[model samples]
Target: MSPSLSIATTVSPASLAGTLVSNSKNVLCSLHWKNNDATKTNRNLKFRVCSVSGGYNTSVENVPFPRDYVELISQAKEAVELAMKDEKQLMEIEFPTSGLASVPGDGEGATEMTGSINMIREFCDRLLAPEKARTTRIFFPEANEVKFAQNTVFGGTYFKLDYLTKPSLFEDFGFFERVKMADRVKPEDELFLVAYPYFNVNEMLVVEELYKEAVVNTERKLIIFNGELDRIRSGYYPKFFYPKLAALTKTLLPKMETVYYIHNFKGQKGGVLFRCYPGPWQVLRRTRNKYICVHQQESMPSLKEVALDILASA
Candidate 1:
């Protein structure tokens, strides 16, 4: 299943775009403004970026890679190991699956996902010796394209950021405010470290702060997968901005190795940046051709007083 982030609010899409661009400008302006209000309010996230290797490597070779990147990779690796002895098993791939149609247009997500998938297909060709990697297209997202690589170990990672902290938290930290899981994350809990396209890559201080949070906080091991360096290239990974991010994450989060996971685009086991389209087709699914899916009538909530059966502890 493909998933993505939701950027919605009460404002119309057009207006939201305008507002975000304006806000982005405002945020940029604050970085230079000496005025405390302007400087303090800036959400410039440049400094929190850093340089590291890009793409897949032995270090990231895991099975069924973790859920998403981490989980999926682990699963892939496990699948690889289990199939090592079975040549027929490795060859049981369906090639056309990964070649399915993607959502049209310049959507960053779609392109990125497609690019990643293409790279993955290529990776399978190299690492698995024809027996393992196979691509196929399954109908999902209302009949869009999906690349399914069998036997290709999934060992990469992608991270989800808690952009705005909880409301009513600290005097300075009250944007989207509360951070509920940093403390609970453990070494065994899979982590996807992705350097996203959402942050400002020019600000150094902000990068430093993010770096600290990942590095000093807990005892669990975490991977700050540098999607930035891998996808975008190094012309802008660290120019006072990137390193601060890597550095700060190291400081703030406890017990972690802030190493870079670079992608190899060349050699046999090189890396690639693929993008898949979790296109608008998904939204279009509601209107199937000739067959309209009538969503059943909505059910109203009933607060009935049911018996409270408490099972005794075993």
Candidate 2:
């Protein structure tokens, strides 16, 4: 949101080659350029560009703009404003400290819920970078809940699966079949972003299969973003399933370069991102290998920090 971070600029149809659009939600601009190919006729292209700037510099692809470009831009602006308003409301929502105390953790604490929101935003920005566009694949098991405003920011082919309401599909071979049929993932792809709640419990078997497929199909990095750790610790997670899940992860650890277990800690306001590798049966059986906390702040660590840690660990 700071001017030093980014500045949006409007450029004419003739200046697409040199024009740079800064990464700012406020700035909605368009550009026109002609793709000149001697083999084919010269064709003019219109793109709605949103340039984001951070430690890594990259540009969004030149997407074809609709004829009602003005209306589209206006809608985008309104959506961004609405998202900001919602974020402000989230910051005001207090954490249920009383409920968290019932868990096996220490006392209560307050954390700005805005921290998690910002972290997710930063995560999307980093994953959506043009360089990652080719290798990264994002999966959101619950898609209907996604807001249009957020979808605009994470522009990519997201595999949205409605697995919660239809749990039967995941219990059998349907889940894998769906994944294979829906997305033709290449072996060269390097990163997978999975946004699913309660990842370690009921869905452990399905998740194991999913990870196996990912490792077999493409030796890529998989990061599972879970927001329901509190529920898991509150006796809601199945006790019998944990051991099986741990064993499965341990066996698959050799093939997985780095398995990141990012979740909100119990009895804590902020979230924690850690690198979890399966090894030492005693350690895994006892404490499940001490998770190396890559990012920890007052509330939830920023997504930029998580992205940097992932790169560093790699």
Evaluated with TM-score, which candidate comes out highest?
2
lDDT of candidate 1 over 1-314, digit per residue (tens): 22221222232222111111112111100111111221212121111111112231111111100112332233333333333333211111111111222221224654554555444433333334433222111111111121121212232312112221223434344223233334523344322222221223322232233334533453312223222322122233453644554553334222222121212122222211121111000000111111111110112111110001110100
Query: Which 10-residue window in model 1 sums to the lowest lDDT?
Result: 277-286
Report the CA-based lDDT of candidate 1 relative to the real structure.
0.24
Residues 47-98 of candidate 2: C-alpha lDDT, one tens digit per residue: 3333455543433323222122232223222332333333311101111122
Q: Using lDDT as the measure, which candidate wins?
A: 2
Least lDDT summed over 10 consecutive residues: which range in candidate 2?
Answer: 278-287
Per model, how many backbone clashes are there? 96, 1
**What are the runs in model 1 whose C-alpha is more than 4 Å off?**
1-72, 75-110, 113-161, 164-199, 202-211, 214-217, 230-314
| lDDT scores in order | 0.24, 0.34
- State each model's C-alpha RMSD to the native: 26.4, 18.5
RMSD of 2: 18.5
